[model samples]
Target chain A: MSIPNDRKYLSTHEWHKAEGNVVTIGITQFAADELTDVTYVQLPRVGATLQAGGSFGEIESVKTASDLNCGVSGTVVAVNEALTNDPGLVNRDPFGQGWMIKVQVSDLNELNALLAPADYLKNAGH
Target chain B: MLKHTPFYDFHVSADARMVDYSGWEMPLMYRSVVDEHQQTRNSGSIFDVSHMGRLHFSGSDTRRFLNLVLTRPVDDMVVGQSRYALVCNESGGVLDDIIVSRDNKHYLMVCNAGNREKLIQYFTAFRREHDLDFDLADQTESTGMVALQGPKVIERLASVLPVDVKSIKRYHFETAKIMLIKLSVFRSGYTGEDGIEIILPAMMAGMAMKMLAGKMDKENATLKPAGLAARDTLRLEAGMPLYGHELDENIDPISAGLKWAVNLDSNFVGVQKLREIAAQGPKRVLVGLELEDRRIARQGTTLATSDGAPVGQVTSGTFSPTLQKSIAMAFVDADHSAIGTQLSADLKGSPSQARIVKLPFYKRSNP
Candidate 1:
């Protein structure tokens, strides 16, 4: 699967898609494939403050658990409610329906530190 | 360096996500752990278990040596019968749990992969100390093993296998020749399902797998290749004890809820210590825990009372695919092991409500 060229990513595998002042956050396809069957996803609550490079929540697959990190400092405007019932979406369609959070960016410049799609795919050794 | 099983090439060809497990490069999952887990429960799945150690023993003193070392009495076992037994240290702490099968001229012992080398050393030392006359052969690398498990396993195997698998009573094994290769098929498995585990020559594993698992890659195939990840979940849900998690040098079979497998009447290496433990009762007992929420209580998580008093620690945990709930196995203070006892699992810093429940969280309706 080709990396979506529109989004920026953290080296840890979280992706950031900025639309105006809001940025949609989710794990990359590579991370999802690595995680296998995602059983549960604990996302930061709406209105919670997130710090760039800080852990916001956790994602659990059958084998193990890993922390989910944020790419930009912002207030969480929304969380994916669908994940509460079906966490496997992250394994099936990680970029689209599996989006975890929508953050209203406090500083748009933080996105510059994130990796571009090509860089992420290269660094992740995809 | 990690070791590879005979099925390593098959796993790679099937696109398995391989991982290092106990110094062995084994497939952790083929596609999805949950899907593989469900396949075992509902239909059937094949597991490459060649990484486990297989030891063969033969001699006039084979049974006597085994009786001296194993917790279970081996004198009365008929040929082709298997018994689950545990090896314990002098203080009754578990060394490893094994399945000892009595064959016509030898005994077969299947043990955990990680404990293979340790057990070999232990057995050799014990044999010399006791001046026992028996032959112990390490056949782990020279032989291959696989478990075909699920509700539909017996029916499916009935068609391909030459022996009458359905007639082979549970816990019994039969020797058969398939395509000129000799093999032993035991009606046994760790997945808490109706299944059989086959042991054959390592060189013939690929051909045997193809013969047994016909067109497994097909979309509607009943027996697909599963991995270590799904096997862990299935065994956990079945309330079986794992070596590193539930059984270790510090944990005894009495405390791990395997008292039935222990024979105090017969004098074994740890019989005296085990007798004391059985009479006085174990200080800690294994129990099943059902968490109120989806958050998993991982191994080493502290267990406490509602008012915040530490009770025990989790040994293994997972979000059970069959039950759709967070379940864990924990060793709690014997006083707090009763069913319906309320407890809390300290998942890192967060507290999750937990309750003691009956073991074997899931049992097949037909079983």
Candidate 2:
């Protein structure tokens, strides 16, 4: 499992890649590996607002169901519709095409509090 | 510490995701759950199911003891026949569902691992009460079990075994030797497929798997290592009732749609209560639920009417890999258990459209 250095991670396991004021958000590869064979994903509406450290969605795997939390507060700019048709993408490419949502950043300062790759790996017990 | 099966090392070497199940550290998957599920349906797959309890009974009083203990009639069973039966409480509640196979010299009973100790205690008490002279042996720890399941299972088994795999009838078991290792092969499985479950000495399990791998490699047949996820989905598709999910102390065979296994004519432990249940139907009945869309209705989800009055509870639910739809088994009020009756599943507070479908959302083409 590759943990991209460019992306910041939350202790809850969600990852955020900042690009200017927009942030590409998804669950970390570590999270996907733990869940295994994701069968369903219920994402928030594209226009809905999110709260930092709040549950933004729900994911269901073969044997488990869990909440997906948001790392930072923002407006949901886009939601991955592909997951509805093929949820296995979350298992296959958690960091790439499996990206869950895109948030228009309301506070760029929030990224400073997120964990770096090294910190995340240690905290996640990788 | 969790118990480890003989295949524990093999699973770890293969990087399988392991989880604690019924006090056993068993592999949840080697590759991905969906991959294994599809492979088992289309090809062949091996499963390490050594956690299941195996008991051997022998002596002059074996048949009488079994007939009195189990809900099935065992008096007419031939040497090579096996019957699916339920061990019920005096009140007709299911203790465990078991498979009793009659060998030439003794009888073999396979019970669920989670209920092993409880069933053993129950049987021991019964034996003392009846003063029977039968010897009961626990073969679970001494033996290892692996199931080769799917459409292509017989061909894969034939590649390694000397006997004709197609000749053994379903529910029948035969002792065979492959590469000088004795295996008690049963032509049965929980999956809705033609498969065989092999039981051997624990020490020889790894060797047997290696031999199976070699045969499959030679034949170029489809065989993969499957896990508990696939096993569960496969059994659900087959409409087979799992013990904890569909059968329990609170649920009886009649309510769980296992009436065929309960022979009321025989005076068993639960005969009186079963007779009472037969005279007056159970208040709640098990029914199959098919979600109209892809949204999964998980277990413990409430089943409600279209207008939103709660009617029942979902026992087991999953995204049916075979049907490519969401399906579940729920215990609903008898009044709402009719086929095609419109219903809805309360999924995280949202009422998802569902309907009562026939039991077994998917059935094997051949079966």
Candidate 3:
């Protein structure tokens, strides 16, 4: 229900926590809340290359399925493997244990175009 | 005009995601569709089944009348008991699939909401043809139906709801009062869980929904309020046939893999044609198909052979929450309906490999 302000947010509802070149990415709390109960998460695989704004994964609810867009371009270094067994973790704690993948940012400058917590919250429709 | 259920405003107040379903403005989900689906599998979920119509048949010749009309024997179905039955035309085509429950001197039939009018006229015409003394009434407008499903529903409902559901057998019902509101509770649901479908009057509909909420809070229980979205996916994964997709004027119950429902020894209206069809199998058959890829094959998509020859078409398709795979039901050539029969589904001109599986794509622990 609460969005953490320390991470970088994307217009596509993904959040990033950058540490040096490696950055952790996950869907925002707002996104998970909007989607309600997540049934399946097709997370990006380790060592997969991704382009910014390109779809890297998918998530399916009961009636519909949606693509998970890549907010930051880079090789997927690490992925949260826990999601396959317990996708509900993403809904329970999107920012904490629900982080999808870790990617080495192709360009750190892309974060500059992303939104701040206040601005992201505004765009998320509260 | 599409009629709104009594709980229509309550759905809006709860912030249910709304969509137009068969011309009626109904909630697709309260929070999330998959979440609600899991709640029914793991815990409990409530549903607004008001859109399903209920028709009452009563009179002295209701027995003789039903025998001449429906494919099932109502005279054999004892009072306070329910039987899944089907009504077919004289030509052996399925008119609709319904549940006929014997209620006192009258017979209560619950049918698809979309075909209520047509079914009524068909039944009425049969009554006139047979010169039977029975009355048919549409109780759907005055009745409200809610499905409380899952393993935990019994524990949660026992606390606040004023009903002794312990005696209500599966597919059977009994009348009880809840918070001074009368209710006809049935121990049957589509979710394949141990639950009850409470039939309350329109004025008391909100009371039932509130009663479930009241019990959830009082017992510190968790129950999801599911909408039609989860209902569709859950039923599809359970391999249950929807009327329009699996049963229609073009299809018969025997071909749709529903032979137990059609009683041949009893001699119904469609008996002559059905007897012939039973001896010789129908043209097409319903089969389950599992796709390996995440790309789903939706309804009406053309089915094809491994070599890309058009064979049949998918009736319903969705991503299964339990199996973590895309599954669908399709009517195909009877010869190709066997298990592991490799085929391809033409998804918008692109073919996707699919394997034929058993009827139900997902089966729960219980039988």
lDDT of 3 by residue, B71-114 (tens): 88877676789889888887888888888889887888889888
Residues B89-143 of candidate 1 have per-residue lDDT tens digits of 8999999999999999999999999999999999898889889999999999999
Candidate 1, B-chain TM: 0.99
Candidate 1 off by > 4 Å: none
Tens-digit lDDT string for candidate 1 (A4-55): 8999999999999999999999998889988888888999889999999999
Runs in model 2 lying further than 4 Å from the true structure: B215-221
lDDT of 1 at B9: 91
Docking class for model 2 is medium
Candidate 2, residues B1-367, lDDT tens digits: the string is: 9999988898887788888989999998877777788888888889999999999999999889998889997988888788999989889999999999999899999999999999889888888999988989999999999999989889876878877788999998888887768898889999888899988999998898888755433234488788898889888888888888988988889988888898989988898998899879988899998888777777789988878789999888888888888889999999999999989898888778889889877777885
Using DockQ as the measure, which candidate wins? Answer: 1
Number of the predicted model whose TM-score against the real structure is largest: 1
lDDT of 2 at B223: 86
CAPRI classification of candidate 1: medium
lDDT of each: 0.93, 0.87, 0.81
Error in Å for residue A7 of model 1:
1.6
Best of the two (1, 2) by TM-score: 1
